[model samples]
Target: MWGYMRPIKKAVFPVAGLGTRFLPATKVVPKELLAIIDRPLLQYAVDEAIEAGIEQFIFVTGRGKGAIEDYFDMAFELETTQIGRGKDISALHGTRMQPGQAVFLRQQEPLGLGHAIWCARHIVGDEPFAVLLPDEFMYGSPGCLAQMVAAYERLGGNLLCTLEIPIDQTSSYGVVDPGERHGAVVEIKGLVEKPAPGTAPSNLILPGRYILQPEIMQVLGRQEKGAGGEIQLTDAMAALIGSQPFNGLTFAGQRFDCGSKAGFIEANLALALDREDIGDHILAYAADLIATIQKGRGLSRDVA
Candidate 1:
């Protein structure tokens, strides 16, 4: 139909995880508040939503996540200091939201993504809403959320971002059983979360970008625990497979798995190398670093 059933004006970011992978630092700072270059993880997710024409940002947070809210509010003391020092604060441009555009709700327990999303039900109301996982960073043309939105307009119903991974690695993500392919989008027949290794129907994995109908939220209310004895979003999504038009978009762009230490470093390197301001410098430095590392390995081999 080439049009969305309803305008997607709001996006939900589930940022309540303990982020134990990045402990110590995360103990003081929420993982979603961690920066990718100069912007926080949550900020990139928000910016992606903005590109998709989203007007509201709803955060499902837990304990020790107050900093996320503060980051969006005015800091009179900091602004005053910057003004007095004649220091430019333009970096903060587009960072603050107009009143009522941002909302934060506490997800009282560490249930699961489905539970966290259910916490924002009242705010989400009865329209389709987006769910973005801040830790899954994606940099793509049209942006991840925008691409999913575009596909939603054409297909209508449930749609999410998908990337093909090695088959054996499918156990690490929710696997989609594809029924048909249309260009970069795959029609979804079903979804299995973290299937046993070698048992996944397909390698395409869901990486935290979704346009789900309001019905899924109703399914989640049942709170049935799936894989990890938690209210799994995959289980709820599975219930809506044939009832509506559902599919996945193979978004075009570089994606970074910022959920781990290695992925985070890789994302930093890849993104830095693509930046106009730092590309050349980082390229030269990386080249030199690789050369030196290779030389050291050669010398060690000769000694052996």
Candidate 2:
């Protein structure tokens, strides 16, 4: 049914969203640059893609995103200054993309995720490409996309990273109508973009990761405004189901929706507690803070 999936060398990151949630902070720094522990959100996504064998990075950016481009480009003066000062240069190694491997496209309009993705269609060409939203950070053993890539090797047409969410919360995500289940992989019978509560087909929500065929670009091209009158990537994906082999990969990982304030803080705290350099200290500090808050509220000391 499937062979060892071809190595995915190209990844498309749609990062043109207006980070309205973060407000003033995002006014200067791109939301993708928000730090999760030590590295930026975009950097984590890039690292994961690299680990999954992605070599070419295609960033679909919008206005005021020059910082993102600069983040990946060589900082010649800074590197030279550090070298002259005898500072370690190793930290600068992972920040660069090899020649011809990084491409950027400007999404002139604040249309939608589908529009942002479509902006990179020419760069993606006809190869199978991976789409990662920097806002959704996944923590796992093998990396979320790597797991989906592994599944794609066997059944390759369009593969989505799916996770089970509370049925009551299905309206908040692109819900999947599952056909058949095989281990962690489910054949996608249909996909509905943020279906109304109780009207959702299934609780299998489409997170921010995708392994799609280039044909999706065509589907997106003719995509009519759905839901919020924006060209949704889910709608385009749904259009590809009958004509292609689309499956949902129930990934083994913890995903953080960094786009939301609560999810962002959770990701920071979770990753902070996993850091060897500061884990124990931060945990202790957090415990002390909780104790203080509890004492102030005249609550029980055995809260934990």
Candidate 3:
């Protein structure tokens, strides 16, 4: 069994990013609160975690992120009103957590993803933990982390959910140096964070899901600023390869990068189009939009 493979009863979600790209909308509303359909981005993440048998939900948030805490708490007034009206409480199901099951930590600075994760060290204690970036949505049956947990049970050190991106685009992510290939799992030899074009070790880029050993906390503690003068978790993870057996699991699912504007819109449309409630309508609308765009482009070309 993977030495690092422990039942994933807890998960850490780092939601302290400035979300500068979203700008004023995010000034008051945490980007994690952005909705894809009827549920918020954070809600989808929490649901995924819950499905993976995660009992404790840990969020490392920043300033102006109080809404995130309230989102999981009991909305007293709303609940009271709903009860007063004798409305079905089922609508509120899955929104509230059992007392003490969910915890929140504040990452005072926007140092980096590593810093945000470090803020959760106290709550994580000395156990192997799972980290999920809310911006990266993984759609699958067993769930992304669930699969990682399974792989971890077999391989044991540090496990990351990796996927094959184009080689030219490897520079945009943490690329892994592949060692022994065993089906979907690959022994991780080394990791390079945002290597320059053509310098990446391999096209296997680390996605946002990870299951790491507690020893990583020590590595992050001593980690110096890398790349953009901010401590990168990838750098710290790279340090553990020689000491521990680190491997990457190529998951079976589609991962949506909800961090970018185009990706976010695409995720919204894709998920909406898959839902039985909205699929037909959303698909028709998308088809109409595409046709309109194509016609407009054709007319413009003819005029030119």
Candidate 4:
């Protein structure tokens, strides 16, 4: 049983951002290398892509992102040490990518998401590809990208994993002008990148995961800067709205915006609290912390 849509074989990870939000830590280490539980953020995104049947991994990186390249490569000395010590090497399995399976392209300038994706055009080569942003760490049963792939199989068009945000918060996200809703999938009438608060078309926002057709590359090639002074992917995607079968799939998952400091901490705690090895302990500590805070607030109220 083959689907009419070309199989999504490649996934693009735009890891070129300088991560200014992460500050000093990011100054030394690329933000994508930051960990949630035991896995680096990028690993989580890559794992999601792999789970979604993605074969080729395209990493659009910039200077100072060498660590990401090394992280995916085989660590010979570490593997040798683990072998000599007879330690379980299961942890190393995910880090190693098969030869020719991974390719890294340099995004020479600090452009934007659109330019970062455009950099992968040559390798993508007329195939429908997936774009997974590592900063948006999603925790779901089958993974967010897997869910989107399932939708893509049924819908067979450009699909953006979407979530309904408060109307006021729509200014922070790429707001979707929705047309019709067919269960979880919604027809995208238009896409507005960070629309002004009261002017947003809808409350639904594109969170990060996307299944885009190759024609978007052509749209982005001559695309002008939008929202910010950089070439925004939202603008390029918006240009293809009426021309293509554009839709939004509202995925069932908890998306953590690891790009922000608060969100990063929240992701770590949330994932950690779900782990078998440390869930109980973390839960207990959290309970105690909440109690202490509540007690302090009570005392303050009594004094007042």
Candidate 5:
């Protein structure tokens, strides 16, 4: 099966959106650069791609996002300073990407996710590629993209990382209409982006990781604005349903939506709590904080 299909070597990262959610902080820094403990969200996504055997990273970027390009480039001054101080520089090794591995293209306008992806069509050419949104962090041992790649190798077609969420939350995500199921992989009968409340076909929702065929770019090329007056990627994806094989690979890990403020703080705490060096300390602190809040609430109840 692997030999019959074109291997996925390139990944498209749609990072062009203005991080309006983070506001003043994002005014100076790209939201993708926001740190979850120490590493930026973009780096996590890139690392996942690397782990999934991606060779080329195509970044679809917008204005004020130059820092993302610099992030993958060699840090000469910093490296020289670390070397002069006799400090360990091994940590910096993973920050720099290999030469010719990264290519950044401008989106030029604040269109939408679909348009952002179409911006990289020339680079992606006529091959299957992965799309990982930096804002959605998947915490797993094998990583989300690696899991999807493994599935792609077995069942070669468009694959989306899916997870079952509460039915009430379906309105906030692109829900999938399920058909047949094979273990963790579910056949996608249909897709509805942010379906109206109480009208979603299923509770399973897309979590921003995708392995799509290059034909999606052609569908996007002729797509008109649908939702929010922006070119909706879901709409374009829906167009390729019957003509191509579309399935959902249920992620076996938790997903953090770092695009919102609450999700960002939650991701920071979650990852910090997972670290061996600080997990216990963070757990103790969190316990103490909860105890303090509970004590204060009990006192207020008594007064009332």
Candidate 6:
């Protein structure tokens, strides 16, 4: 750990993933641009970072992701059209970035999360920085990053957005070896990425939001390919166990793995159903749809 800590002012977004799960839709549009109700998945993550006091954004982008860059730039024509229609463009306010606030870099290879984060090392410099994965959609107040930043301030070390998953699901995440806990904060002694069934140390796992020391970028620099022949961020983080202050914060929020189609649909439905403007409407529609499906199943049984 540094003798004096620097407040996290920068955040890195690793958006280089191929998003293979979304397929043909992702072929032309980045899955990050896919709207949740109305706001794109990427917008939510950026908003979360901003709420956490982030001043600069480092987006580690991949090939064919220019649309993301364009999205943040001034949309002159759109602004003019909205003005002409006398529409309040307040919804578009948070999407604007000040000069030098955002820097996008290319991840030349399809390496793992570790490598993608490593790509932003230069922009991140030597301060503590945040990493937000847009694919992991977080819902609720204070946001995921804001909660982690608060925990990091109290603990003064690296902190991850942690969750206690079912034992069978341990293989799908970076499982943590628990050491202690206070409220939503958990002290972690070890981390294992995607452990096999029955081999994980604990069900608690990292869930794509992090406040990491700059030293981790160096750890990632030397990290070899782990589980999937790609540099795993968990590998570098696990190496920091004994050398630095580390803990996990079980964030207060609902999370969705928007990388998957099911999760994407679920996020939209959940958010829509919670909206004051549309909640009751959607609830009735959903109930009616379920009734229709059940009645159709009953008709099929009668025919059989």
Off by over 4 Å in 2: 2-7, 297-304
lDDT of 5 by residue, 1-304 (tens): 3225888899999998889999999998999999998889999999999999999999999998999999989999999999999999887777898889999999999888999999999999999999999999998979999999999989998999999989999998888999999999999989998999999999999989999999999999995897788888999999999888998999988899999999999999998999999999999999987998888753244553
lDDT of 5 at 75: 94
TM-score for every candidate vs. truth?
0.95, 0.95, 0.94, 0.95, 0.95, 0.95
Q: Model 3 segments beyond 4 Å from truth?
A: 2-5, 297-304
- Report residue 206 deviation for candidate 1 (angstroms): 0.5
Candidate 2 vs 3: which has more lDDT: 2
List residue ranges in candidate 6 displaced over 4 A: 1-3, 297-304
lDDT of each: 0.89, 0.90, 0.87, 0.91, 0.91, 0.90
Residues forming the 10-long window of minimal summed lDDT in candidate 4 = 295-304
What tens digits encode model 3's per-residue C-alpha lDDT throughout 1-304?
5453466687999999878888888989899989888788888888888887889999999888999999998989998999999988776677899999999889988888888888888888898889999999888878888888787777777889999988999888889999999999999999999999989998999989998888888988885888788889999999888898888899898888888888888889888998999999998987887898888753244553
lDDT of 6 by residue, 163-254 (tens): 87789988989999989888888888999999999999988988899988999989999958998899999999999998997888887889
Q: Which candidate do you rate higher for TM-score, 2 or 3? A: 2
User: Any idea what lDDT model 1 has?
Assistant: 0.89
What lDDT does candidate 5 reach at residue 232? 84
lDDT of 6 at 87: 94
Q: Which ten residues in a row have the lowest lDDT in candidate 6?
A: 295-304
Number of the candidate with higher lDDT, 1 or 4: 4
lDDT of 3: 0.87
Task: Compose the digit string of candidate 2's lDDT tens values, residues 1-304.
Answer: 4333455778999988779999999998999999997689999999999988898999999999899999999999999999999999897788898888899889998878998999898998988899999999998889999998888887877899999988999888889999999999999999999898789998899989999888899989985788889999999999888888899898798999999999999999999899999999999999988988878864455956
What is the overall TM-score of model 4 with all chains considered together?
0.95
